[model samples]
Target chain A: MVLIYIDHSEKEIKKSSHEAISYGAAIAKQLGCSAEALLLGTVNDDLTTLGKLGASKVHQLNNESLNNFDAKVHASLIATTASNLNAEVIVFAHNINGKAIAPSVAVKLDAGIVTGACSLPSLQNGFEVTKTVFSGKAFASIKIETPKKVIAINQNSFGIQNYDSSATIEEMNLPIPTASVKVTNVNKIIGEIPLTEANLVVSGGRGLKGPENWGILLDLAKALGAATACSRPVSDSDWRPHHEHVGQTGIQIAPNLYIAIGISGAIQHLAGVNRSKTIVVINKDPEAPFFKAADYGVVGDAFEVVPAFTAAILKMKHNE
Target chain B: MNILVCISKTPDTTAKIAFTEGNTKFDENGVQWIINPYDEWYSLVRAIEIKEKDPTTNIHLITVGGPEAEPIIRKALALGGDEAIRVNSNSNDSYVIAQQIAAIAKQGAYDLIMTGKETIDYNSACIGSMLSAILDLPYVSLANHLEVNGNTATIQREIEGGEETNEVILPMIISCQKGMAEQRIPNMRGIMAARTKPLKVVDPVATNAHTSIKEFSLPPAKTGVKLIAPDQMEELVKLLKEEAKVI
Candidate 1:
C-alpha cells in the first residue's frame, strides 16, 4: 500500500498535499498497490473530495491536539499509521510539515527515504527514485534498498489528476503523544496571500532601492492576486521581513507563476523558485542570472516597468 | 553552556556540476569544497554568538564525512568553534548520519545541538529533525532567531505568512537558517589559532545505509531567455493569459 500524508494548516488542506496524493497514486499504480491518505486533525475540506486526487481511502486522526503541527507527534503518529497499514511506500509533500516529519518517519520504519523527489520510482528491477540535488542544479537517481520507502515529492513537480474514484474516510484511534515544545503564538500576516499557497508570486530584491519603493511590487502582486516575496539580501537588510524571503536558506516555494522583479537570481535564490512552472524575471540588468532561468524576461528599470505591467494586468483583469 | 554544531562540506555555489561513469557517480574532479553556507553563516555563527554572550559556553563542530571534509571542519573551528569532531564515514544517507550524530550527541550531553536547515548538496533537511527524534529532544527547524536563558530557549521560526515564537526547554535541537546570525570571516589570528584547536577523528558506530545512488545527471541547461521590451508589457500579459494560463 502507498500512504500519503495530507498536509493542512488552520483547518484547511494544503494544495501541495493534493499533488502528493496524485504522485502517490501514480506510484501505487506502478507498484500494483492501493493508494491511501492519512490526515491529522479535522480539515474543512470534504474528505471525499480527496478521491479526485486519487486517494482510495482516507484515515484521519481527529484529535484536537493534532490540529496544530508538532513535528515529533506528527512523525511518530504517521509512522505508526503507515506501519499499521503495512504500507510499502509512504508519500509526503516536501512542504514545511512533510520536510519536518518525513525523516523521523523514515527512521521509525527503517525505510529508505527520498526528499525533493521529482519523479515516480522505477520499479522494473528495484525501487529507484530520482530526486533534485545540488540546490536544484542536478538530479540523482537513488535506489531504495529497504522494503519500505518514504518519498517527499517537491511541489509543482507532479500535477494533480482527477481519478473519479470514491474515497472512504475512516477514523483512527491511535494514541497521540504530548508535544515537546509549546507554541507561544501563531502569528500570521493577515489579509495577504500566503507564499506557499499562492499559485502566483511577485518577488522583489535589493534593486528596488528601499522599502519605501515597495508600492510598485505590491501593486503588481495585488493586480495579479499573488503573494509577495524578496531575495535573502533584502531580508538581511531589513527591507523586507524574514518571512518574505525566499531562497535556499529561506522558504522554498514552487508557485506556478513566479514574477521576479528587479531581483538578480543568486544560486541560493534560484534554488527556491526554480521549481515554479513559469518564471518571469524583470530586471534592469540584462546579465542578471535570473533571466537565464526565466521562461520570460523583461530587462527594464522596475520603476518604469512595474507600473506598466501592473496596469496591464489590472486592465486584463477588468476585461475579464 | 555546551552547544554542538553540525557542519556539511558542499561544492561551492559556482562549482560546475557534472556526472561521470554513465551517470553513476558525481564528477568531483574540478569541484571546490566549502562549508555549506547555512552551516557557516547561520549554525556555527549562532553558536559562536551564544558563546560570546556567555564566555563559559563551549561550541564544538562535528561533521560526518571522510578526511576530505576536515578542512571545512577546521575552517568552522577558525570561525569560533572551540574544537571539532570528524566522524570517519562518507555516506549520503541521512538516516545513517543522524544515527551517528544522535549517538555522539547522547554521549556528550550537550545542552543544545545546531545544524543548517539543509545542506546545499543533497538538501534532504532531515538530519537535525531525525537527531531530535533519536535523542527524544525538542527540535526547531528554519529558525531565524534563538535565545537561551538557563534551561529555557525561545525560538522564532518562519511559518507560511508570518512567524511563530516557540518556547522550549534546553537540550533541544535547532536547524538554523539565515537570520540566526551573520556570517563571520576568519581573521588571521583566528586562522592561526585554529591550527592548535583540537580535532578528534573518530570511527562511526556501525550504521546501515538504506539508500544507494543509481545514477546522477545535471538538470537540463536553461534555454536562453525570451526578451520582451517594456512597451510590450501588454503582449506579455496577453501571453500569460492566453498561452501560459497563469495570469
Candidate 2:
C-alpha cells in the first residue's frame, strides 16, 4: 500500500496535503495497489473529506499530543505505522513539516528516499523518480534500490483532484512516543499567506525604494489574494521583513503564478523562485534580467503598472 | 552553556558555476569561497545572541572541509563563535556530513545544535533534520524566529501557505532562515579575538553514505533577452496572445 502523510493546521487541512494525497493515490494506482493516508496528531478538520481526493482509507492517530511536530517522535510513529500496515511506499508533501520528518523516517526504515520530487515516478523499467536538482536549475532521474521507498512531493507540482469517492476513516492505535520536548509558547505570525501554499505571489525588490512604498506591493498582493515577497535588498534594507525575502539567501518558493515587480532577476533570486509555473515581470527597464525569465513582461513603471494591474484584476473579478 | 552550529563552506553567492573533467566535479580553478550566507544569517547571528545573553556561554563553529576553507572558518569564528572545529574531510554527501556532525554533537554534549535552512551549493536541506533523527532530538526547519528560555524553544516556522508556531524543547535542532536575525559583520576586536580562539582538528568517524554525486554541471543559459519596440506594445501583446499564451 502507498501511505501519504496528511498535514493539517488548526482544523483546516493544508491545500498541499490534498495534492499529496492525490499524487499518492495516482502512484498507488500505477503500482497496482491501494492508496491510504496516515495523519499524525490531532486534526480539527473533518478527516473524511480526504476520501474525495482518492484516499481509500484514512488512518488517523487522533492524539492531541502529536499535533506539534517533533521529528524524532514523528519518525518513530511513522516507522511503527509503516511496519504495521505493510506499506511499501511512504509519501509526504515537501513542505516545512514534511521536510523535517520524511528524511528521518526514511533513515529509520532504511528506505531509499528522494526529496523535492516534482512528478510521479516513471515506472517503466524500474521506479525512476525525477526531482529538482541545483535549487530548481536541473532535473535528475534517480532509481531507488532499497526495498522500501520514501518520496516527498513538492507542493504545487501535482494538481489536486476532487474525485467523488469516500474513504473509510479508521483510528490506528499505536504506541505514541513520549514527548521529550516541552512546549513553551506559540508566537504566531498571523496575517501573511504561506508562500509555498499560495497559488498567486506578488513580490518586490529595491525598485520599490523603501518600506513606505511597500503599500503598492501589498495592494497588488491583496488584490489577487497573493502572498507578498521581496528580493534580498528589500529585506536587507528592512523595507520588508526578512521572512518576506525570497532568493538564494532567503526562502525558496514554488508557486503557480509569481508576479515580480520592479525586480531584476539576479541568478541568486532566480534560483529560489524559478520553479513557478508562470512568471510575470513588471519592470520599467526593458533590459532587466527578470524579463528574460518571465512568461509575460510589462515594460512600464511598477508604480503605475502595479496599481493598474490591481485595478484590472479587481475589475475582472467584479465581472465574475 | 555550549551550542554547536554546523556551517558549510560554499561558493560565493555571485560566482559563476562551471564544471571540470566530464562534468564530474565542480571546477574549482577560480571559484571564491565564503561562509554560506544562510549560515551567517541564521547560525552565526543566533549563536552570537546566545553568547551575548550569557557571557559564560560558548559557541562552537564546526565544518567538514579542507585547509582552503580555513579563512571562511576564521570568518565564522570572527562572527562571534567562541571556538571552532574543522573535521578533516571534504565529503559532500549529506549523510556523511550528518554522521560527522552527529558524532561530534554526541561527544560534545551540546545543549543545542543549529544550522541554516539549507546550503546554497547542494540545497539538500536534509542534514540537520536527518541528524536530529540520528541523535533523537526535536527538529524544526525554516525557523524565521526563535526564542529559547531554559530547555524550551519556541519557533515560528514559515510553512507552505501559513505560519506555524511550534514549541520544542532543547537539546533540539533548529534550521533557521531570514526572520531569525540580521546578519552581523565581524568587528575589529572580534576579528582579533578569532585569531586567538581555539580551533580543534579532528578526523572523521565512520559513516554510511547512501547517495553519491556522479557529476556536476551548470544549467543551460537562457536565450538572450527578446525586446520589442515601445511603440510595438501591441506586438508584445500579440506574442503573449499567440506564442507565450500566458494571458
| Candidate number achieving the greatest TM-score relative to the actual structure | 1
TM-score of chain B of each: 0.97, 0.94
Assess every candidate by TM-score: 0.96, 0.89
Worst 10 residues of 2 chain A by lDDT: A180-189
Please write out the lDDT profile of model 1 over residues A1-320, one tens digit for every residue: 99999998888888889999999999999988899999999888999989989999999998877887777788889999998999999999988778888988998898989999999889876999999998887899989999999999988888889897889999999888878778898888899987887899999998999999999999998888899999988998899887788987777788889999889999879988887888999999999989989989999999999999999998888888
Please report the TM-score between candidate 2 and the true structure. Answer: 0.89
What overall lDDT, based on C-alpha atoms, would model 1 receive against the true structure?
0.89
Residue-wise C-alpha lDDT for candidate 2, range A1-320, written one tens digit per residue: 99999887665678888999999999999999999999887777777778889899999898888876666788788888997898989999988788888888877777767788888987785676777766776655566666788889988889898779889989988888787555455545577677767778889988877788888888878877888998988877878776788888777888877888889999899988988877878788888989878777778877777776777666655765
Q: Could you give candidate 2's per-residue lDDT for residues B74-121 as a string of tens digits?
A: 999988888889999987666678888888898887878999988877
For model 1, the superposed segments whose C-alpha errors exceed 4 Å read none
Give the least accurate 10-residue stretch of model 1 chain B, judged by summed lDDT: B217-226
